[model samples]
Target: MSQFLSAIIPNEKYYEKSAFEQENQKVFQESWYYIGLTSSLAEKNDFITTDIGGKSVVIQNIKGVIKAFHNVCTHRFNKIKTERAGNGSLTCPYHGWSYNQDGIPFGIPLKKEFQGLDKESLQTLCLPEFKVDFCGKFVFVNVSNSEVSLEEFLGESAIKLKEISIMIGRKIEYHEIPNKANWKIVVENTLEGYHITNVHPTTFFKQGFTLKSEVDFEVQGQHTNMTLHLAESHKDDKKRAKFHKLLANRPFQPEGFFHQLVFPNLSIGSLFGITVYIGSIKSVSPDESVFAYELYETNLGEGELLSDAISEVVKFSSIEFTRTTLAEDKEICENVQKGMEQSNATKGVLNSSEIRIWEFQKSYMNLINK
Candidate 1:
């Protein structure tokens, strides 16, 4: 029989060693984790060091390739790269073990100590690598080699991401934030519209966007997307009347409107010309988590007026809205975590509105439990 989780599950942390915990490290870690924005490392040799699943990692654009590696020194296992990002051949300060963009070990300061080592052997000693792929300027890395392609994993999201990327072209920026809730809660926040009509009533209703307590879900593999289609009476609409000013500045609204999510919680959402990314995020445990996000779109024009308008109006709206909502979500998730912690006897229930969250939990439970 197919597993059907009832009220007892949602009230419980899926990571807890209870009836709902996930068994797949291949599901969370060791898979494609959204790493960085391609714009962040546009030129060759441009690199970044970011933490994932508690381990530090480094990424670089070599020639035309983007590569990811554990930031630990192969010799002492010390974190190899110290800076968050920069341009250079990577060197481990711990033992002077150094590498190039290809993750090829290049220089070892004291080769005399290990005299028998050949160039190929030293070259092989660089940081280990994960698979990398991109949609637009965003970069994704699979920590463990996966048979599934990133495009296939994205499903319909790939289309939307491609559309947004076309509108924005190659010019954009990335801003990342780490939150204090389980990564799953962050995913839950993005997957539904229920919170918008309530918790975000001020933000949305004020802008004249009518939200619903309901949501819609579509699933593929472990990836699923829940879209919130805002309506005319939304509160954000009036405040966004200025958005109409773009009518004079630009010819028409950009071609697409859609929400994209690949399960275990990586999401990209788009409306008008703004495309928002809630990047690859993972839960450290039942309570703690971190996330990276970027708000970007194409530059509207060449001069000060266009740049100011793009940065101030569109960019500000997208970034500030996500910042506010995520803040609200973190608070709610912390409380949810606490509530779940105290209530071990009963399972939580999901109405149709929460189907996406349920879908996510079921898939996660399946992967982790097996």
Candidate 2:
């Protein structure tokens, strides 16, 4: 990585409505996004709904196969499933128009009232379906109906993502936070640890998770990965050592903290694969975005499981730490967005430690400009 790299994206692009729309169509819609784990939709009729780019999508388990469809009814065009997730058939509350597993509208109340509406006509009214794929337990949805496969979109980083998903045992927490910042601003913040000391002083900084700490970066195609090496002092921390001792018999364990970005959005990280998190941002408008996250703990068999008391303590600590860190980041990102409105700066310089941010901007420019 170069010691210094100039920012490619203009500052104004961060809060411009035009830029946001273009990004919604070009970068987000055309690309794949990590929604949630496949396990979340394991049972029949189980579904998870999300907004990708500007499109609303619902992924559901029909019988045994997982399917993706537009979360809207054909009659009134109302959202079929409004909640983030639930277990129910794709039935629209507006007019009781229920869709089949394949998104075909099979049930419509007062059907005889409509004229020239045949069986094939019902197919036309089928909820528009999108592409869905999985990398291990991780589920991704592409709203554009693009020809690009998820594997192709993920490229070489797909293996690492699959590995991360395999390590997840159960979800501990999931949050969808609204931020007063552009989607790009929120994403760019995660690409660098430069603000760790200032923005996350008490949490990340105190834990020695600063850019000055030992770290490794890999810019793979459209994605990037950064691994933060554990400090000698932290390696010998009494609490961590005790936890390790409890799970020593496990065949596999999470050992390090690594953050991975799967292009446009989707940030996945883990502390020794023992606790994992996946976060992503979606643009609500030019100056607003929604941050969604899912936190998980490593899956361990009965023999390797930690005591409930010990696990609860670890879980509580992890949740509190992450919640605090996210709250800090949220305030700073919004501040940055506010500052962009007053700054006339054209280009920003990045240090070698922020190469991941530079790479992210490069990818963004390539897609946005194309």
Candidate 3:
């Protein structure tokens, strides 16, 4: 292996320890996790069923607002709505009991028999209120005793993202793919541009980016921000000047690059005309992971240009690159799991390059272990 590859220090402490995995009920399911875009369920009665931290949740648009509730039927404990998403109050297939968008029982099979039953108790049975809320086009959820709001959870990072959203019009579409790897694998792949020149050589140097040296890291609570000068400093001024002049309207980064990894499951990055939001959705079991992702750019033209752009990016990320890159990543993560089982190393090294990943692991451990 090359010296740089050998020198790449990786933090495997959290992977080796099962504390986070075993007690994820508190860290994951109970705490807020991102579900889906609010735009996806804009109409009243529109709902989608997805596994959140191993639990089944049905997020819906009721009346004029969005709400989420456990997919379980109150009486028989069966999934009330099985479709990924649709428009209607969730009615139990087992019993006729129905829940409104807020997760309150609007109707029951036998209204007479349960006469004295405090129907309002259903309020206590809300789908689950996340301690944290949302920022612009994206939403964040805290499933634990998150004593913070959406603004607090994101810190200053949310402002940057909201600024990016100003360029996008209407609703954005999400493209997600499943991978057989631990969710952490995906996050590590995104944090730094080190792999860009090689792993995605075609898309990196050949396509649009003119990346610069060294990454800048920032940490707030469990979230992190990383910056890079895409247009290198030593390089000639003409190209760099043109690059900056084009994107000058957007919030400027230290250099020409901006990226953030907001703890455990999200990686958000920005580009001249676009922003890439990547996150993972693991099954109830941690073995399988879903790469939930989307790319947004300013809606420049109407008609076919906008649709074409969305289609091309989605096809590239979710279909083409997803299979090749994600598969390689998944195989490595699985092998890492096997190696972790065999090795009994108590300590791991974190070099300058890996310090941020180390910090991320520490943040995850701190949240779950607490």
Per-model TM-score on C-alpha atoms: 0.81, 0.94, 0.75
Total clashing pairs in model 3 = 10
- The list of candidate 2 runs beyond 4 A from truth reads 232-235, 249-255, 301-305
Residue range 316-351, candidate 2, lDDT tens digits: 988988889889989999998998888878768899
Ordered from best to worst TM-score, the candidate numbers read 2, 1, 3
Alpha carbon lDDT at 156, candidate 2: 90
Report backbone clashes per prediction: 26, 2, 10
Candidate number with the higher TM-score (1 or 2) = 2
TM accuracy, model 3: 0.75
Clash pairs detected, candidate 3: 30-143, 31-142, 31-143, 31-144, 32-141, 32-142, 32-143, 45-88, 47-85, 69-127
Question: Highest TM-score: which candidate?
Answer: 2
The candidates, ranked best first by lDDT, are 2, 1, 3
lDDT, candidates in the order shown: 0.62, 0.82, 0.57
